[model samples]
Target: MFKTLADWLAFDVFGLTAESSMGESVHFFIMDITKIFFMLVTIIYIMGLFRSFVSPEKVRTYIQGKSKFAARVLAIVLGAVTPFCSCSSVPLFIGFVEAGIPLGVTFSFLIASPMINEIAVVMLWGMVGWKITALYVASGMVVAFFGGIIMEKFKPERWVEDYVWKIQMGEVQAIEQDNSLPARHRYAFGEVKEIVGRIWKWVIVGVGLGALFHGYFPENWAASLGDANNWLAVPMSVLIGVPLYSNAVGVIPLAEAMLLKGVALGTTLSFMMSIAAISLPELLILRKVIQWQALALFTAIVTVSIMLVGWFFNIIV
Candidate 1:
């Protein structure tokens, strides 16, 4: 159905020859945009519904005072589900610290929240194959879990800002209350609209870039740089991705384009993870709460963990 609609728009309505390059690019663009937006609306709505049942306070309470292993695990899981982005980092960090959730546990949640969002998972599953999607999620969870543990071992409490320690959230209350099923669904719909409105343009830009690469860019150059035997490919991709910021939804199309142009699975995934998890903007947000030394340590831990995941997947996949 999607292909047919794209075909009609590109060939019949746009008057482009079906076999021409422009025609193909337009069709691919339209098809991808249609499919992605559909998936985004449906999946995000469902995720929002699930998110309604959980609150940051609940997560903080659950992780507080748990065994190290349990706390780390729970933090990672909650991070995966919580609707957090880089913009929320400072406030969430403060809340976690004030609630007595360990720094490492909070870091685990922070790492997983952006890197493994439901939108990213669904897009990966829809755009790539299930095996790759599964690998991405598993690798992300591993990175979050181990990264948090490594930071915990370093004990960087002294690096936190004095103001962050002084500021306290007293008498935490659950942010959301139980509502009728219809009300919850209505709230979910609003969430879906807000999220889609926020990222839809990026989604288009990503898909347009992918379409251009698919139709115009020379494959040979990309293949040479992304050569599987080149050990540098993964690290290079990570380095390139870290400085830029884009959500998983925005990056998926570009990732798909790179993969189709012969990038190694590990290299492409590493790039995507870096973009989602460790952008410059996120670092700026963290700087508000952490000293330079702690920030550097956090960055190092995440970068190393991501690189390790890339190399492992490169070998196994």
Candidate 2:
């Protein structure tokens, strides 16, 4: 159905020759843009509704006072489900700290929140394969879990901003009650509009880049540089991805393009993970909450964890 529509739009509507590169690129752009935005709107709305039921205060309460192991686990799970973006990381971090959630556990949530989101999972499942999506989720959870534990062992509480520790949220409270069904639906729609509106441009840009690569880029270029035999490819990809910031949805299409050009799955995934999880923008956001030393440690931990995941996947996959 989708292919037929794309074909009709490209050949009949646009009058592009069916087998031409321009025609293929347009078809891919149209199909991917349609499929991705549909999934983004639908999934983000549902997740937002889920978010409505679970407030930040509740999250703080749930993770506070738990054993380290249990707290880390719960934090990872909560982070995976939360709907916030990297731009909201500092506020969330402050909230967690004020709620008496441990710094390490908060780190777990922070790392997992942007790295392993609903849109990333849904898009990976739709555009990539289920096995790849499953692997991405599992690896992300592991990175969060161990990264939190390592940070806790180092005991970097002093590295947190003194202001963060002083701020308190005792007076603030979660919603007194849930909104009416109509209100809830309206809120969900609002969330969909906000999130989709924010990301639709990036999505289009990503798909455009992907389509360009799919139709015009030289196939052997990435293959030569990022082939499995090149040990430096994984780390190089991670290093390159760290400075660039984009959500998983924005970067996945480019990653898909790389894979089609014969980049190893591990290298491509590592690039996407680094872009989503440890970008320069996130680092700058976190700087407000954590001292330089702690920020360096956090970056080191996540970078090393991502590199290991990349190498492991390259070997096994």
Candidate 3:
């Protein structure tokens, strides 16, 4: 059954009969649509659940201690398992700062949550190897933790707008006004609404781009990027990816397409990491909440970290 379906959805004229190509193209398109539909619904349901049980208040109460470095590390580990966006983490960021959790610690969570999200890592595991995926996740956490540490040491509180400080110190009233619903339903809806709202557009765009790549990328793209003698794929891809931002699920199809087209593993990985971790959206949004210096520092740190990750995997994988 699976073989038949694969044949129906992924036919190549050179590899299969004409009848199979027509059937497979239709099948592949349908599968793509189906994946998007289900993923959206699931994200909504999960986001709602998250809204019910967790909040800035709760997170603030828990994020304390002399072991801040360890705390930051823990946040990264836990964050990678979570499926949330960089914007949605604002509340937690506020909560941490309010709770006296320290600046670096808060940044740690912010960094890890968006960059090393579950969707990205899971996709990587399916497309790459466990070792590469593990490294990706690990490096993301380190970027957040170390980035936060560096920012904290520099003390960018002066750079933060007075408005963010005000919002951080107290209730963000806007997110709170909808307290009329039942707790369970409210939490579930909150999770879905917040997560889905932020990621939905990116998913659509990313998925469409990915599907295009999957369907049409020429062969030999990988060899061009992966050839060890050409070490620029990692940094070059990262630079190119800075303007783009797409979630893991949205980009996976593209990654698969790139592989099929012959894009180097190192270049592809770097590109994906840049899209996931260092996109223009993240930076622009972050500017509203953080100072220019902190934002620049954050971008620089993550960029270096991703490049390093790319280089390391290039050699090993």
What TM-score does model 3 achieve against the real structure? 0.75
**Model 2's lDDT to the true fold?**
0.84
Which residue pairs collide in model 2, if any?
Answer: none
* TM-score of candidate 2 versus the correct structure, residues matched by position: 0.92
TM-score of each: 0.93, 0.92, 0.75
Worst 10 residues of 3 by lDDT: 13-22
By summed lDDT, which 10 consecutive residues of candidate 2 come out lowest? 169-178
Candidate 2 structure quality by residue, lDDT tens digits, 214-269:
77777677777567878799899899988877778998888777887778988988
Query: Candidate 1 or 3, higher TM-score?
Result: 1
CA error at residue 145 for candidate 3, angstroms? 2.8
What would the per-residue lDDT of candidate 1 be over residues 1-317, giving only the tens digit for each residue?
88999989999999998667788678879988999999999988887677555567778888888987899899898888777757878988998888777898888998998899778888899988798899899999999999998998899788899999899677875465667788779888999989998998889988997888766777786887577778798889888888777877888988887888888899988988988888777888899999989888888899889988988878877
| Displacement of the residue 160 alpha carbon in candidate 1, Å | 0.3
- Where does model 2 exceed 4 Å of error? 17-19
Steric overlap count per candidate: 0, 0, 17
**Scored by Cα lDDT, where does model 1 land?**
0.85
Per residue, candidate 3 scores C-alpha lDDT tens digits across 1-317 of 43454455555433544354344344444455555545566655655545444444545555667478667776666566555556665556656656667777777777777677655565567555697677666666666777778767778777766776675365445355355457757666666676567666766676566555555544356567767557888898888786676766666656655655667666676677777776666677777767788888877877877787778767766
